[model samples]
Target: MGKNLLFIALIILSGCKGISQEEKKEDKDTKEIAYAVSKTDAEWRAELTDMEYYVLRKAATENAFTSDLLDNKEKGTYVCAACATPLFRSENKFKSGTGWPSFDKEIEGNVAYDVDYKIGYPRTEEHCATCGGHLGHVFNDGPRETTGKRHCINGVALDFIPDSK
Candidate 1:
């Protein structure tokens, strides 16, 4: 079932034609920015794992507790799985006990948010500003004295490289 849905999404997105970076813009009132990716589903699937494709392409949620990134204590940047765009800094990662990898903030404006109606509730969907890979959702219920924004991310959407030296 999930595979079928992913194929449909791929077909729809593939037919969108080519979009250039210079044409990318956000609606003044909506604040929604269009993400342009030039990769096809076959190319993306060949490059990413099933779990990564599930989240990045199909928007399917993975078992938070089962993800390895949640327990990862490495010191490095978490980059986008699709395009290798630097999305989250290692300093912002925190164990929010939400099962998934959580972050207080992104590296400056690397993350973008929009309304996601996939699930019944009106949630804030976050994506990578570089390749527009779906990171996760942002919640208002976060730790105090910080940005107060809990970036609930899918572990498969990221690749952590431990810092050396």
Candidate 2:
């Protein structure tokens, strides 16, 4: 009976081992995909501000209605703070009232999407295609008159460039 119990425990442990191995394989696969503006951890830490590093590098969220960009109405382009990649244009900006800066569309190929399970469910996470900096999440609840997609972005992850007249 003791031998049988030990065999059963070993089988259960082996079954669990495959899950972590598969997860590690998936993580490695993701890391293999190169970005345009890659940087070492020290470089990124030195370049970005505290909030910017937290949101862009660590995928942290800012408080609602706390971003100055949320109320911005000027014509400009929003670029990635880490890589200066043009992400969203002023024309695409909208009032989603979710407190973060909301955009209806993104400059194509500037943003990448990944499935994030941080909130206990799968959310479409947006990142800068150039630097792989975390931008925010995209949702389906947007203006019906447009693409019906909301690119909910973190203000700290972006840098706004006003169009020169």
Candidate 3:
């Protein structure tokens, strides 16, 4: 009788051990938890030009007066550089006179806000929620009727598409 009881306990423990192992295997097969674009750094460098890399990865700001899209009147979507996700639309863009690509709003729920202490004053900075790439900064001082916000984006983080006539 004692031998039978010990054997039963061993069987139960083995079954539990198998289940745990299976769960771990499933977890290993799953994707990473972070919201980063799937492409590697090398892939991004290959896709974008040198200037684009300077702004997107190195956080280098482009000249506001030189960006061709600041006064652009065309309609199209703005996509992410690292992941190519649709972020902003032409409709949201406006001339904020701040020398950056200004957007009155984002593409709804895609913008994630974080405290940017880079300047040492805790300003609000935005990033791609899908790939965790930096986009630009947000300010409360904007058009009073429209979204009550200003999304000052770096032109390097975006690829503009012109609308078809």
- Tens-digit lDDT track of model 2 for 63-86: 989888999999999999998999
Could you give candidate 3's per-residue lDDT for residues 1-165 as a string of tens digits?
999999999999777754325423222114454665656679767877887777776566777767766777789988777677778899888889998889988987676767655553556877777766678889997778888789998877887766672
Kindly give the stretch of ten consecutive residues in candidate 1 with the minimal lDDT sum. 20-29
Between candidates 1 and 3, name the one with more favorable TM-score.
Answer: 1
Superior candidate under lDDT, 1 versus 2: 2
Q: How well does each candidate superpose onto the true structure, as a TM-score?
A: 0.75, 0.82, 0.71
lDDT of each: 0.80, 0.89, 0.75
| TM-score of model 1 (CA atoms) | 0.75
What is the alpha-carbon RMSD of candidate 3 to the true structure?
14.3
Cα lDDT tens digits for candidate 1, 1-165:
999999999999887876332344343234534556557679888988988888887777888698888988878988888887788888888889999999998877777777765554467888778766778999987778889989999998988877772
- CA shift at 154, candidate 3, in angstroms? 0.8
Instruction: Please identify model 1 stretches exceeding 4 Å from their true place.
Output: 1-37
Off-target runs (Cα >4 Å) in candidate 3 are 1-33
- The segments of candidate 2 whose C-alpha lies over 4 angstroms from its true place after superposition are 1-30
Worst 10 residues of 3 by lDDT: 20-29
Task: Note the residue pairs that clash in candidate 3.
Answer: 35-130, 36-131, 37-131
